[model samples]
Target: MSSSSEEDLLFAVALLANEEEEKRERKVWVHNIYEKRETYGEFHHLFPDLLKDRSKFFHYFRMSQEKFYELLNLVKPCVERENTTFRRAVPCEERLAVCLRFLATGNSFRTLAFSYRLGETSVRRIVYDVCDAVWTKLVPIFMPQPDKEIWERNELEFRERWNFPNCVGAMDGKHVVFDKPANSGSLFYNYKKSFSIVLLALVDANYKFVMVDVGALGKNSDGGIFSNSIFGRKLQQNKLDFPPDKILPGTNELMPHVIVADEAFPLQRNLMRPYPGDESKRNTEKRIYNYRHSRARNTCEDSFGILSKKFRIYQRKMQVSPEHMTKFVLATCVLHNFLREDHPNLLAELIEEATPALQDLRGTGGTYTGSALRIRDRFKDYFSSHAGSVEWQERMINVGRRNTNE
Candidate 1:
């Protein structure tokens, strides 16, 4: 109990505490294999070899090396980070490559972390940051707000390429499945019995996304989702800069520029759905209208098909949060549009020869306004008229009927 004995005891306790703290700090900042990424990572070792073989490079990144650099240059300002005294930041090119590979292969962060020689958490953060940058920088360039001229151009392409008049774009929704988040029960569950978020898109005739609304709950019907989306609200408010009504090709009757969709969407003055019921199928004029509608709407179907097949991320359930998944989906769409113009052959090969028609999610019970009904009628009449009819229309209709009967 002497003062000298107490001082010695206090010194001993302080020495033990310092040793324990040192152990904890060493565990927290331990050196690992990932620290040698500059020498061992795929980006450092394998990517240079890939550049020598263009085909392999394209397959690895889902884009040409040139395109990859171009994209990096575009998004560099947003994704680039400053280095600190502790460590240098991951290069912008490497960050973009990590994101593109994640989207191209849908690989998990653990798998990507090992391949890139980075921490799993670091991989996840890089994927999200690069995806956000891609969406922000590319969307305005690739999928800008459409004005009257853009809408008119799309209408002309639809008429020339798909044989549908007064149509600006084909509208549809795709369910991007993902793992259910904690505490989110049944909100993201769809009739397909999977958790998903809707990617509601309006695709142009050229298989490019004109506008997309991502991150709606899967349980909601496409109609409801579209009605609640920002794009849909702008459409409803007549603020989308759509061209005024114009006369149909070869007809004196004026019709509004309309978006063609399946029955999941309600019929509106600016939207058209096919004539329903067995009665319409029996009528030749109605049959022709449906045929043309399907032909034009097939663009949207093909866009989804190409996107899913090329990106491959939508093929599996994503593991990220819904917010991050939205960014991922939007980035993929921007890339789809960007690649569509320059790499048409590549995208063309991804299209399924016969993508089955999407089922009608909404039954035939909703009321249609008189104006909407009349707009559809005018289109039906136009398709059957001489000016709008293609030469092989009857033959195609007969073939479809025969196939159905058989």
Candidate 2:
């Protein structure tokens, strides 16, 4: 063919290609949402007026107006965008609102896309960015940065409020359930028949999470997770901000400030666990010690209960990766502490989610050191003494025998 014939063919092809590209770009598709998601944009866009109705306000945002505004302001610098000539940028308020709704409801990006009036892809980026920002900006504020002063304060709160002496925090492990990832084995799968990532946390007396070591395999036992965790390793190496030795409530002998947990954590001088009921000793004193330890340990249990209830997403399995799920857990925990300021009852609504066996007081797989055993003895002695005994202690001891008799 001649050069002119080839040029004509190439020109025609270029014009057709441009026409196809424009047609694809200009095509408009619409869906019928059936009005279910109407509240998605309206209440979020029209705030203070909607804030007057507390139930409606909280039902959507999962946080009060004041708290939402406070968070919006805190994350505004990171999430807010500058408008360009191309199209107007998404406002900071809307960006944060999109994330809050995602965390609050655990709805899919597609489901929230309709509610927030954005593409599913946009919603995905917004959710991830806001979660990252919240964890980065707010973690330092909400998470307890323990030191000498903070540790002492925690001990005081645990003693005065929970009636367990010299306790710093209640530590526990929770499996944040998620779907098995493609191309992965049983690595993330647990005995519960679901894939999950573990969140090993130390919760203070006030139901606030003090420290968290997340992203452990769900199949790992709590003791295993703790021993392998950053917080656990630090505690073992004596590198954390644990307070110096303090005198026992009734004795002149000084003991290390410690965290109370069930048998799932290894017993360290700085960490206390309950006595194994099946072992050699089932004596009344040991029983009393177990009772007192359970009292302190319940703080962690109650913390998880409140956490799961407040963030209903935790109750269901997530579709994200283990890494992203860790972010979600940390973000929820930060919000949990922030919201607890206003709704401080701990509102233990989802206590029934985990079984007693899952929450069991199994001793950590680590060998018990002599000093750790001594700490347990010291606490046991204190609980039996007049200085540490609550008015209900004796009755609680008797009630145990009564249950056995029945």
Candidate 3:
């Protein structure tokens, strides 16, 4: 039992371990994909040519390196664990991939992880951490609070083009359906008979989603949805910083600008809706209002459309719980705004051009009416109420006119 014999045995064991490690390394495959699948392929689909110069795309479209590093600094503090139970430690690129996947495809974390190389649990954690970073840093930077001048200009533009003065943005609600929780019954079900969360949003002229509130039960009416929202309260208390004392572009009306929603909201002096009724005459008036309001309100749909188109995840079913959907919606909105800001010219060209002018309206844009106030009332009354008399409807139009004038 000499020393040489013992050393020889130890060396043989070490050599075997080295050979095994080399075999494992040889078996591992890591292929870099420059182009992406049809869905969730922002960098690839929208700007395929840029993939050849990936660095240029990052340089042109992504945030500046300093800002990105700042974002990294914010996220580093939230990583939380030094050692993870998972076999491989999650890298920054992987975490970023989750964020990008959410933005690019709006896919569920489970689906994203399967395609992007990570566990579902890790994907969830990484998405939330990156969201925390973007929500704290990038969101505020990209979505700066609208100033008085911007609001005033928005109102002026609305007045001149749409006959709705002092309108900063349009409000709308969209439903995101999901599987009903056990024993939840009809509670989460909507008119569509599906479990869902309604996403309420305010989008601007540029088709940028500026504000959003998510996680309202699907059963809730759009008005019911908005009433419980923080944005709704802000309007009630006049907390929103609206442009003050402005003349409606074509008319003499003067008032602080407001947000235009559908007939599903309660009438706040600042919120506009169409006239409510069924008589052929009254219906015509309501239609006219809805038409104009739709012109403005349609931006919300456009915002949703662009989001779904880019993320494709929305086209498929969502897999996250109702609560996490909030984060998903918020993150998507931020991403939409980011793309709009970073690639304005591209988006501008991609957006459909304005259609031919409506008849009699003569380029009045789309539609408008007192129907919003009616929706507001219906929502406030929980959707019960006989249609107001035609005379009363006329009076509201008058009041609306006066409100616009004042």
Every candidate's CA RMSD = 2.7, 3.6, 11.4
Model 2 bad stretches (over 4 Å) = 1-7, 10-13, 16-49, 279-281, 344-364
On residues 78-177, what C-alpha lDDT tens digit does candidate 2 reach at each position? 8887887544567788788878877866788788787666767778888888888998888888885788888888899989987987898898887778
Clashes of each: 0, 2, 26
In order, candidate lDDTs are: 0.85, 0.77, 0.59
lDDT tens readout by residue for model 3, 44-110: 2444454456444443334333334445665665553464442345556446545755655456776
lDDT of 2 at 31: 39
User: Evaluated with TM-score, which candidate comes out highest?
Assistant: 1
Give the alpha carbon lDDT tens digit for every residue of 141-213 in model 1.
Answer: 9999899999999999999999998899998887788889778988998887888888889999999999999
TM-score of 3: 0.63
TM-score, model 1 to reference: 0.92
Estimate TM-scores for all models.
Answer: 0.92, 0.89, 0.63
Give the CA lDDT, 0 to 100, for residue 345 in model 3.
54
Of 1 and 2, which scores higher on lDDT?
Answer: 1
Candidate 2 steric clashes: 2
